[model samples]
Target: MATAAVDRVEMSEAEWEARQELAACYRVFAMLGWSEMIYNHITLKIPGEDGAFLINPFGLHFSEVTASSLVKIDIDGNKLDDSPYPVNRAGFVQHALFHRHLPDAHCIMHTHTTAGMAVSSLEGGLRATNFYACNFAGQIAYHDFEGVTVRDEEGARLLEHLGNKRVMLLKNHGILVMGKTLPEAFIKHWSLQRACEIQIATMSMGTPIEVTPDVVAVHQRDLHMAQVPGGAGAADFAAMVRLVDKIDTGWRA
Candidate 1:
């Protein structure tokens, strides 16, 4: 197998901060045991309308990731960074669609958590049976299992499933969330994965579940409250960076 060579470049403050936040997201996922080796990806749109984004190289483990180690690539999945590591074609397939179709989504996150896979396997998929479940309500979208997402055909189907929504529970696969910033994507995923876990555990009780009325209205009101544009999510991201600093500050390397 051929390896893609990484070209080193100077990153501005914004770019570096993006990388660190993205890397922290990877580490947090790894720490939570959400990683499946190097198989999953969390991508952030490069700071321009150049149709380029940053993604992890194919070979490195999530724990080995660093801000400088991230590779820049175009929507076509071609490496703009000259990095020796190839970007995972499947990762690009889903990421490109979200970034290309959703103008507001600047960061695209995906994961293969245990509870996520469990939720994906169910018939209804992500049931709104609890408080956190109400967070998604009618907002969640589903993409049927289409094998691995390495082909162009899969991209269109995946895009159609994504529609105008911000989150997709890829049936029998994993979870993907998109946002305008790394913090938004990360926090959304955190909320989404928690919702899945909560639902599963609640269902285990084998008792009847009650759903809140006016779910769509609640979701609309909560969307702003969940990611207040420039508020708690941003602060949370900053705090996460500090947590990364406490242990694996090597991401800045």
Candidate 2:
């Protein structure tokens, strides 16, 4: 396994820990098949640094990402570090908008998974047919596709569409989820993907039974109430990190 180089510039313990956590997140994405080559992005804000964040180097695959290799930048996408790689401009555009505007959104993840893209193309988007889907009943948003999100102006429209919501389905594009922490973001994406997968599978079997709106509301409320501090998502993410370490420790490097 390739070892990560030590950070040449000094970083606080918290900052270093954030880098390691973000790197682990990228590795977990690769292991779970959530990464779309090097296309999509998962970005995290640097702890204690206003408007500063860490993102994967543009040319590296998620599996190849390492703590020391992550690029640090401000909200405007200007590199704050001396990394040889450039930031993916489109990724910076989208993630920067959210990180800048949303105080609670410390981590933002975007995915172009098969199921996510499939559901995004659907007319109704995610259906409230299963428990997984029900969990996002009123908490999801949808942004109309305006082609690739490379234009800086599109960030305003994206944020407008995502108003106060944690999950968003980019119509005819893919999925984006934001959270206060990396584990929260990862768990949200996993749940959203599962919901899409379940929706597609059920639809393939001809007409599917839809859950009643009242029941869906109750399920949503129950989920909100059951969410404890550092819930199952934290445990699941830690376990996945362990699995990744067991297979290849390069991510930590």
Judged by whole-model lDDT over C-alpha atoms, candidate 2 comes out at: 0.88
Model 2 over residues 40-136: C-alpha lDDT tens digits? 9999998889999999998889999999889989998898887778889889999998998899999999999999999999999998888789988
Top candidate by lDDT: 2
User: Local distance difference test, per candidate?
Assistant: 0.78, 0.88
Total backbone collisions, model 2: 1
Give one digit per residue, the lDDT tens place, for model 1 in 23-123: 78777667667788888999987685368788987888887787777888888777776566677888888788778778888888888899898999888
Candidate 1 residue-wise lDDT at 153:
70
For every model shown, the clashing-pair count is 9, 1
TM-score for all models, in order of appearance: 0.89, 0.95
